[model samples]
Structure formats: structure tokens, C-alpha cells
Target chain A: MGARERIWTAALIVIGDEILSGRTQDRNIAQIASWLNVQGIRLREVRVVADDSDAIGEAVNALRARNDYLFTTGGIGPTHDDITVDAIAMALGVGVEVHPAARAMLAGYYETRGGLTEARLRMARVPAGADLIENRMSGAPGIRLGNIFIMAGVPHITAGMLEALTGTLEGGAPLLSAQIGCWVAESEIADLLSEAERSHDGCQIGSYPFFREGRVGANFVVRSTSQAGLDACMADLKAALEKAGWPTIAGGI
Target chain B: MGARERIWTAALIVIGDEILSGRTQDRNIAQIASWLNVQGIRLREVRVVADDSDAIGEAVNALRARNDYLFTTGGIGPTHDDITVDAIAMALGVGVEVHPAARAMLAGYYETRGGLTEARLRMARVPAGADLIENRMSGAPGIRLGNIFIMAGVPHITAGMLEALTGTLEGGAPLLSAQIGCWVAESEIADLLSEAERSHDGCQIGSYPFFREGRVGANFVVRSTSQAGLDACMADLKAALEKAGWPTIAGGI
Candidate 1:
């Protein structure tokens, strides 16, 4: 791929027993994915693992090795189950230590609420040589060690961290998309959709079928890193649907 | 572990470019996880990969090797993007073939709507030696080969497949849980929570903190296979919180 066409990718690891146990529906995956898109980075993959150290370590190592960036949500809290720091440190062949800057930040944030107790101070711990990612929503900051980012499990806190890191990471062209919906079963236009995608370079069409109003319909999404490519592909797809006697709805149903 | 205490685990693979592109929020993970829990099987891990064949194949091979059961969602439609069958077949060292039962089901269902075209017939292709899992909501059925199940990406369709397979798989004891909510910061009683979990055998406690009504609060979830163990752990934790001058609410806040 050329420089302008290069794709920057990232992988996410959602670390929480609540999600795996079905007690909590994960909001971080979509949140992070949208945030990464604005930064011109594509979220290539995601893994939701438990709070176990071995599981955390294995996923961290595997994903970080392949992707341009690795992000983890959850398991950075003050509780005993918050073992992400230690596990990631072990995976990187490093030791965990309380970062002085993070300690000072926690101390300042907790001065009026309560002095930083041992439990609260646990949030200051980071893998060796890791830097802090500012957390505007809470006292404990997110950690960034090399290409790996350890973020809060809470969706709002993770959002704040994403905001802080915005415009800081190097990325490629943002992927653009357009949606066209039709009150026709996708199977009816599968050939047209496939042919449109094949003719349009660097564009992919995804057909999402739904059942509503006792009728079958589908919303076709076209994605491309190039705006012209996306527009051309969508135009051709819409024209193809029209030629097949199916009216298209812009922006989906 | 003893046979009575054995754990049955399943891993999930969510395949879709729409999810990776941040256009769609994935509902299958929580839905499947909750369903697996009722079946006395633990959802051990989840990976969301894109619609690419190699990505799908690699995740399918890796997750299926470790878990007792492996379930996949998405990429099973008649659209060209629906390549889960081919990818999984390649991963399992098998060939793809049109299953006669699946073909018959599609033919019968589409006979009233429209004659089954090649696009609709694509849904009948499955990995060689795969059995069809009934789909009452749609014509295309889910595929099951060995311990791997290929289900729909849509939540309701996946639920129907789960309903069909209920009580058919072998499982261990179902995990039980209780909840206690308190208006105190989790850090204030982190040590007590850790100690309570340590004292209880086979019981795990997860503390989830939230900000509500301008106050800090947390809900502690205690999980165990034995009801007595869960009860003992919850009682001790609640008493410990009460002794520390914090009131506890049963069933969480």
C-alpha cells in the first residue's frame, strides 16, 4: 500500500469479570472503536478476557505485537481484582512500581476528599518506565507503556482518556462510510452488491438485513479510506438497486 | 478438578466489519454469555474479528482449541461478505458443501416468497459434515460441526438457536451470585473485601463502583458454584461493611 493508503490498526482487550459473567454489558468496545476512527486508526480486533493475570498477559502480548497500538479497558481500579498493571508488566518482562507523577496527581485529587489511602494509592502503580495518560474523570490516570495503553474499565473514564490522547497518536486517512437502505431482502440484491464492490477499488459493501413491519429489509454500508472511492461505490450501488426496481433510502432505515 | 466440580467453558468469535468499523454495536457477546451461564457453561473468552477470511479462520482455530465449546456469530448470510462457512471449513481442514437439509429448508421457505436464486442458495453451504441448527425466524439455519457452532449475528436469531440447543449440551453446576450495594467508596473497604474473598473458599467477589446522585457507591457481586458458599461470603462481607459504619443494601442499589 502507498503512504496515503496505509492502514493503521489497533486492538482492544476488555478486562473485566462483569462483562464475561454477563453482569455488565460492555460499552468500551464501541466507544473505543469510534474514538479510534476519528483518529484515523482502525480497530482491527477485540478480545474480552477475565480479570485473571495469565489471560490478561497472553492477550496483551499477542495483540500488541501485531497491531500498531494496543488498548485495554478495565482492571485498573483500586480493588484487589485490578491486576492489569502487574500482569502487563510481567508480559513485558518489567517490574511494577508506583510512578511518582501519578502518586502526586492522586495525592492532589484526594487531598480534600480523603488522604490517599493504601488502596487508593494502588492506582498509581504502573509498569516500569510507563507514562501516565491523563484521566480527567478520576484521580487515577491511565497508563501508557510503549505502544500499549491501560485504560479505565468504566466507559466514561475511558472516554476522558481518549479525549486526552486525541490528536497525539500518528494515524493514516480516516475510513469513510455511507449507508443505503432498501425495503428488499438482501438476498435479492446480493449479486448487484457484490458486483458493485468488485468494480470499486478500495471499497467494501456490507449488507445488514433486518425484519421490521412484518417485512424484510436491508441496509447496505459502503466503507473506504478514500472519499471519492466511497462516493463512487455508493453511487454505483444505489444505481444498481434502482435498476433492480428497488428504491434506496439514504442514511439507512 | 473432580468430575462434580468440573467447569465447561465456551469461547465466542464475533465476525463483522461493521462492528470493527464502529458502525454497529455488538449485542451477541452479552446475549450469548448470559445464555451460556444458564446452561451451566462459562463464557471464558470472546474475540471480535473482521469479515476477512484469514482473520476469521485464525480466531476460529485458536479459540476452538482451548475451549470446550466454540461459538461464532455473524458472516453467515447470503451476501458475499458471509464467508464464515468457508473460513471455518479451511480452519478445520474440511471442504465446503451444500448440506441437503439446509438446501431443502431454504428451497421450501423461499418457494412462497421467491424462487431460491444462487444468492439465497449460498446460505445452504456449510462445512462438510456439519449439522443444521434450526432457525425459526429465517430460512437460513445455523451450522454445528463437532464442538463449534456457527450462529447468526442478529441477536434474536441467535437467541432462537440458543433456545433450540438448550439442555442438549453437557454442563457442570450452574454458577450462583448475590449482590450487596453500599454508598461508600470501594477503596475505603478494599482491604476488607479482599480479606472476605480470601476467607471464603470457591467464592469470588467483584466490586463495581459508580457515581450517582453526586455520591460514590459500589455494588459487590459474589459468585460461587455452591449456594451456601455464596451466602456465607455475602453475609460476611455485609457484616464487615456494617461494622465499618457503612450500611449495605441487598440485591444491589
Candidate 2:
């Protein structure tokens, strides 16, 4: 691959109104980001769209156009709003048909539960030409077609499937960063800050501010995949701050 | 109010590397959004920038320009990463000086803890021409100037101070809302959905998809401040879905 060879990436479509309405907590984004970081794969953009079929289809089409992979969660259940399969099928210009394997998995789970009705069979509907992504937690499998993986929205299952899939992906080398956090304002080191930035050619240094313990201050973070790049940049930034008479009162995390 | 009567809104700047590095879970955005909603104010945008002061200043300026108010969290501690005051001061083209109230609050908290070293006193430096927002959890007080209110990033303190200040300020009663969450897929009822939408007046409905209990589905949420408007909207949407053969399933949580 040449220097310009792009790495693999995926966009997350969090299909739930719970997050927008502030009812349910979202654990998927952070979990995915962490998993992707370790695998060196990047979870680029995440959009939490409403459970409207049009909305879902629009998002799916948009993401599929821009990214290497797409993962959608929510809207695949037995109920009315479980229209993900249908939506994706429509978005991809395909038909909705039960994948024999997916139906078998759902049958196994529902049959053991002692009742499988027409409603239960609704869970088995899969878009045509899609392969099943095994679900280790529960039996009903996730569907994958043309780089789009439609999985369960439940955090446990989402994390489980993502973990199962991460090993196969090839992305950029994981970003390594070391940072020291302290209570200081940003402007105190504004001038030398730019010089320090110019000094660190290959590394990126960041400053952040927060309001906590009833005061306002910032944290300075120097990040690089390379350790030596980080160390040199930090040294310059710290020295600049020290000479400015706003030496930090704390260190580390 | 004229069309130009712009509503006051805010965006939060989470300035810790813990968030960017996936070390900490953010509790600020939702908490603040919920608070603002009740106050009839809107929180329109949120950005998570690393603990770099330059990034902090940049985001702050952008958000402040679009919104009538802005609130920031984290980075006000007595440690080095606490650079929010400096960031805001610089963005405002002002200087950083120890506001008497902040110094007094720091002294009060430190006196209770132990010594009031220079490190502890660093918490006292607030932006010039800003008023103090009292932090009851710890003695460090946040500062406010113009429409920007800087508060602690810690959830507990942030909530406390937010509750305290909002209590004293008078607010307009913006439209309140109710939500509906049930299992259904979007594609199952795409056409009648738009017809139902056209029938509504001042209400808006949002849908979301989720996978739960090994099934994927969508969660439909219809919201409106007007009771009559919401009732009419819900009626049309439900009638349309049922006619389309995707009725809301019973016994769903």
C-alpha cells in the first residue's frame, strides 16, 4: 500500500429515540470507540437517528456512501418498529426474505421458550443476499450484506458482536497518547502555546478547560503514536507555562 | 415577540482528555439538557474537545457566537488542566485576575481541608468582569459573564449550581413535550406516515430504532407542548399504522 492508502473505518447508526429524549443511557458509542481504538479501526461518525423507516433508510444510504463499513442497531425486533431489515432492504434496493439460517436460529430460541407465534417469526426476516453474523449471547443472528451489519441495539449484544468482528478488520495503528491534567486557564499559555505547537512537528498537543470544584481551568494533553514525539512536545509546553508564572499545581490523571 | 426575538441556548465544552481518550463517561450533556429544557431554554449543540486551551478557546468562541448562553464544565479544579477561566478570559479579550469572591470561596474550602497554598489559590483566578456561580458541593465558585455560565464538570456539583441559579432566574414557558416508545419498524408504514405528518399542526414526532431481547425494532416518540395538538397527532399516526397492518404490540415495556 502507498502512503496515501486509506485505512478501514465504520460509522455507527444508533437507532433509538431514548438517547434523544434523555430516557435511556447510551453505552454503545463509548464501547465501540474503545474496541475500535484497540483494533486500530476507526469508528468515524456516529448518528443517533429516530426509528422512522424513512430516517433509517436515509441514514443507512448516506453512511454506506461515505464509509468502508456500516453498522446499524435497533429496529430489528418482532414488533412494529422492528423495521430495520425492511428499511435496509429498501435502502439497498433489495427484497426482504427470511434467511434460512436466521429463521432457524430464531426458531431454536423461540421453540425452547415454549411459544413461537407469527409475531415471533417476524424476527427472522432478513434482506436478500445477506450473510448471518452469529450472535453468541442469543440465538437470532445479525445480518451482514455489502459491508453493512445490522445488529441488535441492546448494548450487551452490540458489544458482543463488535468484539467478535474486530479481529478481522485492518485499520490504522492505534493512537497512543500520554497527558497530564491540571487546574490552569488556557490564555495563560496562549502565546508560547502556538510556538510549542510549531515546535512539535509530528505530535499534536491539546488544551482543554472544565468547570469543576467551583472554578474554571484547563487540561493540556500532548498526544502522538510515537512516545519520543510526545515527550519532546510536553517538555516545551511545560517550560513555556513555567516561565509564564502559571505553573500547574497538580500532575498526571 | 418578533421573528428576530432569538431564544437563548447553550453548548457545553467537556475539556478533559479522559473523555477523548475514553477514560471517563461524560455526565454533563444530558444533565444540562434536561435542566435547560425545564427552564424553557434550549441546549442546541455540544462538542467534546480535548484538554487543550487553544481548542477550548476555539470551540467556546464558536458556540458563544451562535448561542445567547454557554456553559462549560471540568478544568476548574486546583490542578494544572483547569484552564477554562483562562480560555474564556482570552476569548473575551479580557485578562485573568483573582476575583475576590472566587478567592474567598477557595480560601473557605481550603481552610476546611487544610492549607491554602498557592496551588489552591490558583482556583481563585477567574476572568475579569465575571460574576461568581457558587458551588455548594465544594467551595470553589464558578463564574458568569454576559450569557456564559461556567460551572463544574463533576455531575453532582454541576447539577447543584445549575439548580441554584435557575431557581433565581425567571424563565419563559417554552413548549413542553411527552414521548411514546414502542416496538415497530419504519419501512412497514412509510406512505401513510407522511399523510399523518401533514395532519399535525404544532407537534413533531420522532422515531428511533433499537434491538432488544434478541429482536430489532423502532421506538416511536411523538412530542408536543399542546395537549390537544399531541392528542390529534397521535390519533392519526396510530390509525395510519394500524391500517398499514403494523399495530403496536401489547405487553411491551
lDDT of each: 0.94, 0.69
**Would you estimate the TM-scores of all the predictions?**
0.99, 0.62
* Candidate 2 backbone clash number: 60
Best by TM-score: 1
* Model 1 residue pairs with clashes: A74-A153
lDDT at A7 for candidate 1?
88
Angstrom error at residue B168, model 2: 4.6
Specify the CAPRI tier of model 2. Answer: incorrect
Q: What is the C-alpha RMSD of each candidate to the true structure, in Å?
A: 0.8, 8.3
